[model samples]
Target chain A: MSTDLPEWLLARQEPFQHGDGIAGGKSIRRGFVEKSVDSMSLVFRESFFAERLASRPGLLQGIDPRVKVLTTILLIIVAGLARHPTTLLALNLWILWVAKVSRVPLPMYLKRVWLAAPLFTGIIVFPSIFNVVYPGDPLLILINFSRHFRLGPWTVPETLAVTYQGVWGALVLILRVGASVSLAVLLALTTRWQVLLKALNMVFVPQVFIVMLEMSCRYIYLFLQTTSEMFVARRSRTVSRTSTQEQRCFVSGSIGALWNKAYILSGEIHAAMVSRGYTGTPKTLVSFQISRLDWLWSLFVLAVSLFFLGGDRIVAW
Target chain B: MHIPDGYLSPQTCAVMGAVMLPVWAAAAKKVNNVQKTKYAPLMAIGAAFTFVIMMFNIPVPDGTTAHAVGGGLLAIVLGPWAACISITIALAVQALLFGDGGILAFGANTFNMALLLPFSAYYTYRLIAGNSEAASSRRWLGGLAGGYIGVNLAALAAAVEFGLQPVLFHAADGAALYCPYPLSMAVPAMALAHLSIAGPVEGVITALAIRYLQERNAGILSVEASSSPLEGHSYKKLMRGLGMLILLSPLGLLAKGTAWGEWAAGEIEAKMGFIPGGMSSLAERWQAPLPDYGLPGFEHNLLQSSTVYIVSAIIGLGIIFAITYIFSLVQKKTTPDKT
Candidate 1:
């Protein structure tokens, strides 16, 4: 082994890499490993963001999670019942206001809700806004066929135009989805995961369900780390990208291997539980405390729900 | 695949939620009665395994990566009821922590993904693999068929749910207030995506996984059988033949057409005489928060509109990372060192 090195070379350290990960045959696809790493990082990033959002000192954060959970469901129901566009808009604004009070980054909150909702919903609802799907008065004429075209049981009209009512209907659907998602996102962002799970007890959520939620949340990161480690180990040993067939083989093998590990991991976890005082029921230390503020918030939510429902009925009549 | 909130009427959400409550309770009771205290940790691990399985983006021959819900695979491995419980928990976590699915729509999502998928997968696998030996290649074939059919069945169930919305619930003007598409459109649209893309990916993965387990260590199959090496070559050949078939399956999706309901307004008008009254009447009712996914002042012109969408996406991503980074920094600053 050569021990001698230049002073500059000795002082500078090489970046740490996964051990012996560069020795594969010529069939390797480096992109595969990178893609896995990228997705793994994405999982971690999302969790980190959620944890940060949950811990912020804000309006919803201070309330008891049980109250928040119930209130959110109630609000969602109200939002769903909303028929008038005005009422839906108001509810959306109210959710944004709640998000603001809860100290969630407003821009990020809007961005999150809108990005997920409108982009996809927009695509889904796009065709609904024309004269062909939902018939109504034409808002804008896009084309005029020389003669009506018929295909099987369907008929294509001579004139094609965007319908007035079709666009209206599409708008309502988009707004409703966007608002609903906003409220749901607000609830998740403002409450800690464990606390939220525990709060499900108030709704009589089964203890087993709660236990599963807690355990899954706890071990997901652990398993995720293990998976990335496995990938890294594989990548470190490969000098070139594996062939597609080999890639598929590796993926299938990894899935089976992971399942076996999960089986063993379950036994180990069970044994650890037993060692800790094996009981049928697992308990956590966090206790719920409902303050006047929680009650006030609950009352506020109830009142809003009533008003929205009432307004909807009035608008209907 | 997740139906966001507001796609269903409140009545629909309530009805679905009521239906799911009992299923969850029964599943919990059964699991508790069977596994008792040990059930919690094992099922949790299983659910966690499922969550990670979904994260693996398996590359298919079409130059696209697909993820299997693993509902069928789990059903086969842990039994259907256990799989149901595990998947429901994973879905709840997704809805609560990540907002991948709607909270109010949780029941519908659960019904489709958890109950429909796993149960269908279980029965289909059983029907095909009946009385087959533990190491029989037939078992793997059963998995392949079950996975392909299971996913398509679940997709069908979802499509039905979505399609029924417009017919079952509508405003006075004959406009659909919930999902705008009729069954005529929803079924084919959903079927095309699942059958062409997701089905084969799931089938191949499930079959390959089971085959690998059988070859590597059949002990995980939880069956007590004498070890034998005599049948190895035949099994290998069977798998290779199946592999070739799986590779060609994506070609079915190459049909020169878009999903029925997925066409643009212009495209639909060109295809049909007029938009369905129920869908068009309701669509014009409200403005999107981001009309056409662009900022208020910058809603027109292709260049600016796309730039706005991209900018908004980047902003959201940047802010999330930035806030988390700041939180970490703050925690470090506040904590006292043990020096």
Candidate 2:
């Protein structure tokens, strides 16, 4: 049966030599920069597609950016205030509806929000479900120890089970996280970056901050492209896996070189701006126009938020 | 150390936000006095550099890859104040654009990664480097220690913020509604992770980066020079900021055993055999405008409360700036030749 297995199923490496014990057991993966560049590019592509979605003639895409920003904040606040799981679920469904109308890719959107929240926040909340961690009514027993026990200064519970309250609390916590993340993701996907930044500006974000944020956003892609090229050039020149010290030295050197490049780039950028009569304040060509539809949408969102809050207040759980 | 939303209570967020506003105002004033126009593009690039640096994946010896937060390097390259603003902008972008952290939790995140991380790192580096020549090896050692301690301190702050959520806010059943972990669990886990992995990685990177810069360009630190008009006024400002934070820290203690909304008249009686007078009075009182950190007479809504908190923070920030300005003026009169 082992011989019948595919050759690719087995690990490929040199056999252990004389005096070598578990040297071959170690797994050393290469292409760190290549992997990072690939992932970063993936994120860039996703955000790029999202920007394209923002230009489409979708529901949220039509609303004023200021309204959308405020409405998103309002909805997120409601999500934070929510106590019941059902309320959070309803908010999740509402975000789905928004994403659907906004024409964002539903699978990508769901995967981005759902896969991340449960995977990251879920792990944090996982321990809370055990009776040993959080004392409550037993829901399902996982282990049954002696009648009583003691470990050091801490008393040990005789039985270990998933508590009903713990499970409910975890569910509520997860749902809140999921709902908030979904709303944030929805807002990000359905709005242009510049427009969203402008909205932040109108909402009393300092001009200096807005200027820095806009400039940073514009230059980040350039820097990222430069960084990836540097890594690829280095990788192409490599013969085999270099020592860890060499890698560390290379990373530090690359960082320093990048810093130098950024320094020069800043000077050049400043010169270009000065030549163009640029002042400290940032001015954009795209202006915000809140239409009648925007007001209606704002009211609709307000009503929805109030309804959720009222439902949370009335519900026992 | 980026705290996601719902991990901290709103009150905690408000207090931190209030604290940061003054610090930001002070930083801006100081930066403006140093290199007014030159610092603008530099700060912008610094922010962009920070944003890009966080994306770099470094392979550690443990057969796993982790990225650097770049706070220590930012402080070394730019001054700590400039680093604070740059990292704050980067963090805000991360929170708003990418949803990496919570919008509501931005204040706490900034307090941890931006202020505490860079300030602690920069000061530690300065203390250790201690008038050593620019090319001395002590600078590198200082960088190493600064970077390691910087990341650990940031992690500890974040862990405390997370641990406090459950103790400060929970359901009536004693079930944690926010972060479920208590301090004992949070602190040790955070400390161990940082001490073992990220701290050392940051230390190595910081030291190596400094050495590389020392070899290549000697003019980098000039862009982050220390001289400023308000040089002699930092102590009072720091004290005022800490005083504000201390005043608000007790709010965390106000409802030590109280849950969010599950308070029952008989439940307190059953637990303590008598309801504490303070607790009973608090429950009876009407909602304050700022509630906890907000101004009074604001509407009993989150938006209103948050708005008031922001206003109060702005007010506090202006007061700090005014005091600093007056102190500088007085110093200039008393010792006109000091500069």
Candidate 3:
């Protein structure tokens, strides 16, 4: 039975020291386990930074969470509705200006917004610039075809060049995405998660749904941390790299285990809360109060959104 | 698919939101009845489960890692209604916390992932695994097929939404304002990526997880798909909605063009520069009882046309109910009675 066991189960490694008298050695190669752990840590770090950023007394922090949420949603919708690049550019600038006053680091903030989803959107829309795609005035001819010929369904043009109309359209789309993402990022960076969930009622989200969102946000960390620890334990016991089959088995087992834990914990969580005099509705010590300043700031943001909407409608060709 | 904001036009986003509203309402009611007051904690945990599941890196054939969205598995275990709420909450967290998806496109994202993926997958699995034992291979294979079908359908839906943009909206010069790809490109591109890679990954992961649960906790697997949530529901609510829509049918006369695909041959020619030869030959094959929402004699009269619109709405609703009634009667007659 002992001989049939894999190498990982045979014995501990030599000089593989970890803290608190536990044997551990950093793996030489980065596998999926390490990658997942690093990713989880990155998530925790991002969340921690967001909490720190939210604690700071920024311009958005001064406003009530409901007002802040409402204004941010309005601005995001405006960004989506905006058809002109100029309007989107202006919205992006305004968002950055608020982020600057909110004590959020501009460089990190910009990178976070631009580097993730919008960057992907930019790549996806890159091909629309070609004349064959948009079929308009040639802006930059990249390839001069031998002659007009059919390549399957599409007719090949004399030259494959970027078009003015395509470039303009793509620019507008990219700017719109940038503006919308910036507003959303700024809101997430400035507001506490629990308060933000509560404030979703301003958008007519049901009370029960908001409560669900609050609890889920609170537990995402718990589950991620728990899963990360499992990886840490695996990393500690390993001397050599595991095979892909073993890795996949570990992953599937981890998922199944987590699901079981979640199912059991859900019952326990409700029972514990009930014992602690809990009700169906979530309660917070600090109640929401809208002040005069909140109203004024919210109104100002609303006015700006309207202006952008008008500008987009007027300026779009 | 998590559609980012600004990708879909405002109108399209609004339409998707409208489409999801009833599904959300139904899920809420169904889950509430099942879990009662205990739904919050269960759904929250389920949501967190999916959120963490998406973080797991599955090894691919290319020696790279990919993550499954986990919608299919959630539907399999938690049932469709609960899965809908769970995935929705997870999506909301992603949108608000990590800036992963568009804030405004939240509805569209939920419509695709939370509703379509879960419902389609759940039904597919249930259809294939009907009356099978908990440990049967047919059930696990069904889970696999469900996952594959679920993700691919979602991809197709996302592709169609993206493809519709150029056809529905554009700059005055014909440059696409939103997603630039036409249907031919968007559909095939999205389909290939999902069907070849994401579909199999999602299917394998779902099947593996289901099999693991089958071995460890057969009780949970047995409880899933045990009964329909809306089995005892009344038709009163459905009737009321149709009544309201019938009353409001005349308002649709305010729009100029017919709904897409319902256009006449002349209107098709006006929009597309020419009617297809097939459509031209088939144009006079049959005539609508109420042409353009009006009676034959009431076409030129505005008041009569509006009245006829209401009548047409009633006729449409009547036909639908008649068909439903016939189906139910047939189902009743076919089933064996213990008495």
Candidate 4:
């Protein structure tokens, strides 16, 4: 079986990919070998998952999912209301500390949150460079190579200008995006998916939506696993065949297949749910209980926020 | 895209809130009506679908990533009211749970993306497709066109909202409102980019989703088809009347353009026929007050006055009439068929 595996697949299967090293790999090898190991790893290390682990957690995790959801929303409102970079940075750092105390792995958190950097940077870059509203001194200029012309006497050049204000604006945007993304990630990681759904339901996040999310998440994994197996089987049968378009088509077809499977699976799942006496509401054996620690944490966060607001007022004055 | 508190002047935010409140209330009330209740589940599903799809961003040439808002698709699948409610809820969730948009700007954001774009697209689709039994191909075409127009309109709306901040708020540095790269440039650039790219992405996604649901569980989209009847004489006549209104409304305002210009010229001549340095003096007087528009400078000369007024009027009237006609048609059709 090992000999039949492709070099690329084998290389990706290394223990370090799991971030647990060789020893940890050996311990889990028995169970891991039976499952679609690649998918399991991919699912575990998805960027969003990592981001969630990096965010802050709280008493909401200990309380009913619904209560936790309300708090999460309240927290987001507080974060969104912050305008200053200092406030955002301070909030981000506090959330980071919370994640740290909660024992989320640093590497996973970084890996996930880092994916947003390029996209966020792009949004700010253009606005900063050609900012018509707040034009500052030009930092750089790029002349267009293709579009060169002469006007009567003097030569005319096509150029794009980048300004200092643009750079500053870009930095501010990055900080804002970082703050928001971090907050969101923290919520996802600290709370279980089910709890989060329950919390949403509690907050009047329409029941139909909650149900859709639950079903989608549940079936997504199954779809991915089945598709991965099908892809592997196809690859094994069609060796030495490679084309980007073909590959895309194959993946899309596989997605279509997964959609069909999901359609059928829903009916089966619904039947099974009915048999188990499942109603619209989900049942959890574990009840949430908030301790003194939750109250202390909440107050601390509030105080920190207040301090930032006070500082903002002082600065404005 | 979310503007935080303190970015816009308090006055601007308040005005946006005032406009948003009534529309939101109306949407909620419409959603509550028994006839619209059948669409509730589909709306919920559509919202969830939008949330998930937006997460998968496609990179653009400028290194920026763009995602389809799915507003047009929702409007096409469900009626405008249902789409408005679903998109509003989705935007709310994203802001609250994901921090994707700002809280203070939620009302503004909802108004622009949820209410304006989808309604615009739905109307456009109705115009292009006409009053006929909408074939599967036409539905797909409508979905594509609507999605494209909806996303671009939303982006434009956001740009205008941002641009108006300084003027509406009386901010210290008014330069932001009338800069070399004013809201006009920013709004179009953003709108065009999304119009070209994200529009197609949304169109395809919408088409695929509709096709999927239609094939497997036609019941899922039954509310949409039933409520938004594609065939009706009253609706067609109403749309045609709207189109006529849009084309003619500008005439009412601009009809006296020549007279106004003549009157202004006569006044200026009566005061002093080509007074030496008269323009310079007038410029000096107005420069401080209207630094961007009123400033007595070469910058004002660079802009064509008639062109700006005419274009703005046409665009504004066009949008207003288009949306009005579309909503009226949809309401008329959906009323009797309400399950």
Candidate 5:
């Protein structure tokens, strides 16, 4: 039966190695590889696309980007200031709930939140190792490692042990990052980029910025499409092509060409914009109303955030 | 560089906002002054280009990467005040639309990258290129120096913004929280890294683009000439302008040396005493309270102290220039030729 499986199926069956060894043997095969692939397939399905295509109809969607902007700002502040693990965890759970209520897909939420993993690893894990190895805190000695080496006479005694505090700190950092990223992703997913820009403009965001963003967003897609076509053309021209370096060169050349094209296109776009009476400012059709729902939502979120913050303060006190 | 909200004290953000408002107003006023109907399209296009280019990150060695915000390049082409307004707009849009930076930090970010960098680069370019013929080599060199200073100035501004978080805000322990990393260490490290990284990226792009534009459409350069007397000059005159270049190089070195000296002095003072003044006392008074600078361990290290100082000086210097320019606008009627 195994021999009858196709080469691609065999390749897909290969065991995956995780950095932390947190996953069990069966879980790695079932959870990571199979489940993730299934999740990705679901993400790209017609139904999924259709759902996304359907205009956002929630209270959050209609609120001005400016108000959303304010909410985002408040959320980030509340999350960052929540020092205790319990509070941070509560905030994370609340964010997850909000994401669920807002109809954000689970896989999409997980993928975006996963970006925080690397940051957590770099800033928390890497630094925590150094902290644990040092002998100042007894808590550091309890968690990470067992080695200890004394420096010269003047220096404070150092140990190479990971402690409880170091582990706790790393966990806290991860939680913080997870919460922040979740909030940001939620905002990005819920809010349309154009509406956000308009809302920003209303809130005293400079006109130059709005116009720049509009042009760049428009041009970037065109640039990408043009470059992809160029890439295909280059691939067809090349004989006996398979070298990574050659592929890189071809891509880079396409990029250089794309840059020139973009420059020229900018001029054309500028002329077109001028002909259409573009007067150094971007025009948007979407008008923001700070509806009662927006106010209620903001207050509810604020109340939840305050609860976490207040709880953290009380616990620490 | 994007100091998230709550990372900074409310007071510090307010101070930065107060300092930035008039500079922005002045930039707006300057834009109003140059509001020729023909120039409007070009300005919009230029603004668009700024946003597009910044999205393309040039890799740097220090784990962080940067891209050309083109504030200096824009200032050279569109004059400082107009550049400020345009760059400010670009930054604001980036924050809101793309999440490239935090919205709350918008004031500091704009003041640092837009107002300070461009104006500084313009003055530096004027000093180097002078009122002479624009040689390709001289132009490249001026662009290189302008770019180098401009990026470092921006980085310094970033460090200061980070450092001031601890200074203006009180930690849970009631101690003044400032950036844990000293400016000396952080500044040199950042400046040196960016000097090799974003500096070259900006220089090459600015020079090549400027040259291409000059060759293909000299009209754009001509438009800039009205606002900037330095543009469209002969290469011979700019070469003769080498005197200022020679003088400024040594002056830059002296300034760097003095900055290093101050940092060294601070370190020596900290070492002579066991406690490092502000945060340490706060830590002592409030047991297990979060360190003023968020970093948990390694609080008293020399590396951290030096970084704080270097970063602060960069921010302080940029702030000084921004403040000076705002004041210059107030005195603009008297100094009509300065722009």
Candidate 6:
């Protein structure tokens, strides 16, 4: 083959592609493959960092995982049932206190739980502040749609304004989510993945589900690695601009291929398991021991939750 | 779509949770019977696949991306019960491990995504596909409808949950608790999102994946295929066969004489040299409804006779279907239920 490209081919300005390495753009757009890889890596990193924290000589790390899981769940439930912001604030402080004593970095812990909570729950509750939404005392007048008119079925008030009650409600919602996430993230931060799964198994999740959960966790990494390779290979070979339609096709085909691999792999895994004297029902030899410390931890969490709950009710009454 | 903690009131959450308990139990029972413990490994793999599948970010029209839940696709391949279990386990892992969904809202999420999605998809696909061949376009269409309807219904359920918040729970001070959006606002916003984006994405992905599988490994699409009692032939093949028989019916007009053994007593004597006593005697003994496949007073002319023949043929086909249905019912009764 001739080394020199035709002049016509070189001169031809193709309807330019951007973001897939070859195309000119201000920034590289991370396609689905890269996005998926990043997500998978995040999972691995979370688990890895969690393992390190869980192994440390921290307050929660010393307790039984089963106990910690239950307490965490109870705390979240308490946060959900809390009507008063005082109870919610108390829960947040306790979460921070627990994180500090557990040897988890307060800043990082706060960021992980707090940052995402406000962004997600804030957007949801923000619109609640409008006068037409909750109909309370106005805090800030937003926009007036001139005369009060019906936008289809909903009536757009003449003066759209933010309400004090709406803001308070938003604050309560954000706090509730933060407290719940803080407790949830704390449980994860201070517990090993294996121990967590076993804890869940002991907590009456079906054995079959436990087995599946165990296997799925193992396989996610495998598939993620495969996906990374597929994307990397495509990047390596791209000499020209490919259309978005073609990229979409590749993505769909990738899904089909991934599913095919998973489906076939499952059968092979099953057969191999059967050959090794495996039955559908899986039995594990692991056992969890809850000590006095675990019981004490559980009781402490319960007492604090009850105290705040009662105090909130008294305050409300 | 994953309704996080604090979005739903505890009472509302508990009520949704309670509703899902029976559904989960029924799904578990169904899966256990259909797939013995040996199916555990596959289920685990399926669960893992579901977890990962949702993470896929498909780039869409407006320089954006969307993720498919993959519940409908799972329902098509694994059957609704198994898919339900698989998605439930996947959701559990996400909640407990990653905190992607709330632990308290697990049942509610399962109710919407796991129970409603797969069950609705499975039945819709089943209704559409019927006993059509695995490779048929009808199956693909069914897959599309299943996925489209499945995601929309789940979205609607979640929307209803969000909408009910302000209505169901409020503070003594007149502050709205939980979600502030009423049913009117929540439903339309959710309907627009799911109906516009999620519905088509799910439908296309499911349909294309099925088509790909049909071209690649048609053997694994055997869950529904194996249960069909149409012998080895599909309904498409049955229809073709019936059409073939209809087309060949004109060949009867080319015959010179009465069909063999279909002759009257006089004709039998004239053509067969002799009439056997048993056949001649018993031929008159068998009385029948719609004798000679003719409607009385409808065979006076060619047009009338053709009408009679067409009507009789339809009646015959209906009778065959009825017999097959009765036989299937009998077979179902005779067989012991796995439970």
The whole-model lDDT of each prediction reads 0.76, 0.77, 0.79, 0.52, 0.53, 0.76
Model 6 per-residue lDDT tens digits across residues B1-339: 898898887666666666666556655655665556547776778888888888877767776778899999888888877788889888988888788888888878998999889889988998998888988998889989999999999999899888877776667666776887889889999999999999988888888778878888777777535432223334355446545644653243233354366688789888778988998778778765655555777768878776775565455444434433443344335434332
Which residue segments of model 5 deviate by more than 4 Å? A1-59, A62-66, A116-121, A128-138, A142-178, A206-216, A219-286, A289-291, B1-18, B38-43, B57-71, B166-185, B211-219, B229-339
Clash counts for all predictions: 41, 1, 0, 6, 37, 1
Residue A312 shift from truth in candidate 5, angstroms: 3.0
TM for candidate 5 is: 0.62
For residues B171-280, write the lDDT of model 4, one tens digit per residue: 12222211123465567776776767766666655555555554555554444556554344544564566466446533442332222343443466666675447655
Model 6, runs deviating above 4 Å: A1-27, A142-152, B227-339
Better of 3 and 6 by DockQ: 3
Q: What is each candidate's DockQ, to 2 decimals? A: 0.27, 0.18, 0.23, 0.04, 0.07, 0.19
Chain B TM-score (model 2 vs. true structure): 0.73
Q: Which is the winner by DockQ between candidate 3 and candidate 4? A: 3
Q: What would the TM-scores of all predictions be?
A: 0.77, 0.82, 0.80, 0.57, 0.62, 0.78
Q: Candidate 4, after superposition: displacement of residue B283 in Å?
A: 48
Show model 4 residue runs off by greater than 4 Å: A1-10, A13-84, A114-133, A136-170, A200-291, B1-41, B51-70, B85-113, B134-137, B165-182, B204-223, B227-339
lDDT of 1 at B245: 41
Could you give candidate 1's per-residue lDDT for residues A1-317 as a string of tens digits? 46688777766542223332345433333355556656776778877887787776666777789998999889888888788776677667667766765678988887889886778998989998877777777889999886889989878877788887777678788888888888778888878777888899888786667877999988888888888888778866766546667877788888888888898889899999989997888776658988766676688678768766655654454
Alpha-carbon runs more than 4 Å astray in model 2 = A1-30, A278-286, B226-230, B252-339
Weakest ten-residue segment in model 4 chain B by summed lDDT:
B170-179
**With candidate 1 superimposed using the best TM-score fit, by how many Å does residue B27's alpha carbon deviate from the native?**
2.2
Cα RMSD of all models vs. native, in order, equals 13.9, 14.5, 17.8, 17.4, 16.5, 27.8
Q: Please, what are the lDDT tens digits per residue for candidate 2 over residues B1-339?
A: 788776666677767787788788877777766756665676788888888888888778865577888899889777788889889988977887888888878888998999989988888888888777667788889889999999999999899888877777777677677788888889998999999999998999989988988888866744455442336677487768778776876675454554555667678788769998888887789664544555666758979876775565455444434433443344234332311
Clashing pairs in 3: none
Give the per-residue lDDT of model 4 (tens digit) for A103-187.
Answer: 5665766655545543654453446455333555556775544565776863444545666555544444455555556656656
> What TM-score does chain A of each model score against the native chain A?
0.85, 0.88, 0.86, 0.67, 0.72, 0.87
Pick the TM-score winner.
2
Candidate 4 TM-score to native: 0.57
